[model samples]
Target: METSSVLIINLLVWFLLLANVLSFSTFEKLVLPPSVTGPESASFDRGGEGPYVTVADGRILKWKGPSVGFVDFAYTSPNRTKIACDGTNDLKFGPICGRPLALSFNYKTSDLYITDAFFGLLVVGFNGGLATQLSGGYKYLSGIDVESYTGNVYMTDASLTSDSTGRLLKYDPRTQRVTVLLSGLSGGGGPAVSSSRNYVLVPDYINKKIQRYWLQGPKKETTEVFLTDCGSPKTIKRAVNDGEFWVAVEKQVQQQPVLTEPQGLRVNGSAVVLQTVPLTQFSDMTLAVVQESNDALYVGSSYTDFVGVYKN
Candidate 1:
C-alpha cells in the first residue's frame, strides 16, 4: 500500500453495517512508539493474544494493553541495525535491512509467517526473535495467509518489475516446497481463504478485481472473478462474527500519492457488498487494512503512527 498524510480518525456516522450494526464509533486508538510508522497488517494468535502489527522499520510490534504499549516482538533482517533502519523509509535499505509487508500466524503451530518486500517468506516461533527464511526470490510479496488446518501457506507475488502479471503461490510445509497455483493476476493484496476452506478470495490491484481461486470441491484449482467493482482492493480479512470479509480499497491512480474516496467494505463470498464505509470521513488516511476482530474494525495505514479501532 501507499503512504499518505497522517490523520486521526473520527468516524461520527451511522449506518447499517451488514444490517447488524447499531452504532459506529471509534472504540480506541493504539498509538505506535515514536519515530516508526506503518502498521501495514495485523494478526492475532490462536490464544487470542494479539493485534500484532508489522512496521516500516522491518520489525513486528505487539500491543499489550495501554500500560505496556507496543513492545518489540520480532524482526526479519539478521543484518538490520536499529541505528540504520529504525523509522527510516529509504528504499535503498530495504534489501539490506528488510521491509516486512504482511504477516499471518499458523494458529495450529503458533508460528508466525511473514512476507517481506525484500526478504521473501519467513517464519518465527511463539518466542519471537529473528525469523528464519523459508523461501527466496519472492520479491514484492504483498499478502499472505496460512491455512491453519493443513499448514499450507498461500501468498501473492506482485511481479511488478518483470511484467506486472502477478501470481498466487502456495507453500506446503511437509515438503518445504513452493508451488505456483495461479498466474495472470494483479496480485497486490493479501488473500483470504474461505471459512469452509473451499476457496480463497484473491485481490488484483492491477485488474481491479477479486477472483476466487478454488482449493477443493469440483471447482478446485480453478479461478473466477468474484468481485470487480472494488476500487484497487488491498487487503481482504475475514470477519470473526460470520466469516464474511472486510476489504480496504482506494481510488487513486497508479503510483499516485493523493487518494480519493478510500473505503472499507464488508462483502460476502458471493461477491455481494453488504456494507460500505467511506473512509475519507473517518480519516484522511489511505488504509491498506480494515480487519474485523470481534465487533470492531481495525483500520491500518502504511504511514500512520496509530491504528484506529472502529466499533459498531
Candidate 2:
C-alpha cells in the first residue's frame, strides 16, 4: 500500500510541473526600441492593423508584426523634433517634446485621438503624421476614448496638483466644442465608453475607484461609483466581449511603498468582477494598460520597454 501511494504522489507532482510549463509557454515578450520606454496605453486601428502605443518619449508607434517590429506612427506636438524627443523621458521637456499618455481610435473617421501629458487633446488622421492639437489648457491629460456612433471624444485630466483637481472632458467633433463633463476627479486614469455608447467608465487612481457616467439614457449627465477598492486601477479598456472591460490594477505592498504585483480584472457593466488574471510576472512594474483581443492579452507598462503578450 505504501509503494502504491508513492507512485500516485509522483504522478501528481509531474502533472503540476507540466501545467506550469504550459502556462509559461503561452507568454511571449515583445521588445520595443531602446528609446521607446513606457508604453502607457495601446489601441488597434479600424482595420485591426495595430497595437499602436504611446511611449514616454512623446511618440506613438505601431506594431508591424515580428519581421518589421514597431514603426513611428504619430507625434503629439508640432514642435517635437526627432533630436529633442526621440529617447528622453525628461518631464521638464514635456511641453516641447510632448508626452502622449492615452489614445483611442475614432472608427468612423479613421482618426486617432490622443491625450498628451503636456499637449492636451489631439488627433491625427489615418495617414499618421503630425497630430493636430484640439485643446491646450490641461495640466496633465491622462485618459481618452472615442464614441464610435458619434465622433465624441471623452478624456480625463489626471491632476493639476497632488490634490483633487482632476476632471473629465468631452470634445464634440460636430460642433468643435469642448465641454467639462465632471470635475473634482482625484487622479483619473483611463476613460472607456460602453459598446452601446450610452455610458462611460473612468478610473480614479487616488481613490481606488471606478466611476460610471451616463451619456444618453434617462440618467444622462449623472455620475455614480461603479467599483470601489480597486487596487490603484490605471487604464480601463473595453473587452472583446460585449458589456465587459479589462482594468489594470497595481497592487502595492502595504509597508514598502512599491508595487509588488499587477493584475487585470474582467468586469461587467453591472460592476461585478468576473475573473482576476494574475500579471505578477511583470516584475516591479505597474501595468498601465491591459487589453484582451483574439484570445490573447496585451499588457503595457509605463516604465518598461517591452509589451507582454499572453495567450488566453
Candidate 3:
C-alpha cells in the first residue's frame, strides 16, 4: 500500500510539470494585434511636428509593457527624426532611457530630463547624454516637466499606496533643490506646463478630471473639466505654439500593452468639445511637444511599441 501511494504522488508531480510546460508554450504563441482603427472614444477630429503619424512597427518594446512607468517620446532637433523612449535599458546615471518611463528635452541646455518609475527625476543627454539623479526615496516618480526658460523641473510622485504620499515637486537645476508643489492626487500621471509658463495641465486620475493650476500658490487658479470619464489619464502635454494638447488614456488590467494606457488625443481649432481619441494598445503616457511647431506630430506608445508619425 505504501508503494502504491508513492507511485500515485510521483505521477501527480509529472502531470503538473507537463501542464506548466504546455501553458508556457501556449503563452509564447500569443500575438498582439498588428494595426488598429480610428479612435473609439470620440469622432475623428485631428492634429503636431516633424514625424508624420505613420505607424512604425519598430517602436514596440517586445519585452516591456504595463509593468513599466511612463512611455514618452522625444525627437532630435533640426530634422526632428529619430525618436527616443525612456527606460528601455539599464544604466547607472544617464542610462535612464531604457527602464520603462518618460522623458523630455531641454533644448536650451541640450539635456534630456527623464521621469523614472523606479529612479525618480533624472536628466541625460542624447545617445551619450549626461545623466543626473534629481530625486530618490520616492514611491514612484512617474511624470516630468521642465521650464524652458528657467530650467526649473517639475515632476509627479505618483505614490498612490505610500505613507510618505504622492505629490508634485519642483526642482531648481541651478540650485539643485527639490520642493513639494502639491499632494493628494489619487494617482498623478501626465503633466503639461502651459505655454504661458504660469500654470500646469494635469490629469487627476482619482478625481477623473483634467486640471489647470497656477505655478505659484495655485489658490487663484480655476479647475475645469477638460474631459470627463477618461479611463486613467496617463500623460498630458500642451503644444508650444498652437495652444493644442494631448492625453494618453488606459483601460486594460491584464497582459497589458506597452502603452497600457492608450495612444493619445489631439486638441485644436478652438473647440469646446475637447474631443479625446484612443490609440489602441499603446498605453501609459504620451510625452508630447514642448511647444507646437511646423514639424509633424510625433507620438510614442508602449502597446504599439513604436513612435507614431502624424502630420498636422
What's the lDDT for all of these models?
0.82, 0.85, 0.48
Q: Per-residue CA lDDT of candidate 2, range 93-159, in tens?
A: 8878889988899888899999998888899999999999888887788889899788999989866
- Find the candidate with the highest lDDT and give its number: 2
User: Positional deviation of 183 in candidate 2, in angstroms?
Assistant: 1.5
Q: Residue 241 deviation, candidate 3, in Å?
A: 4.1
Better of 2 and 3 by lDDT: 2
Clashing pairs in 1: none
After TM-score superposition, what is the CA distance of residue 7 in candidate 3 from its true location, in Å?
87
- lDDT by residue (tens digit), candidate 3, 97-146: 22325555565765667665444666655442234566666766767767
Alpha carbon lDDT at 109, candidate 1 = 94
Clashes of 3: 43
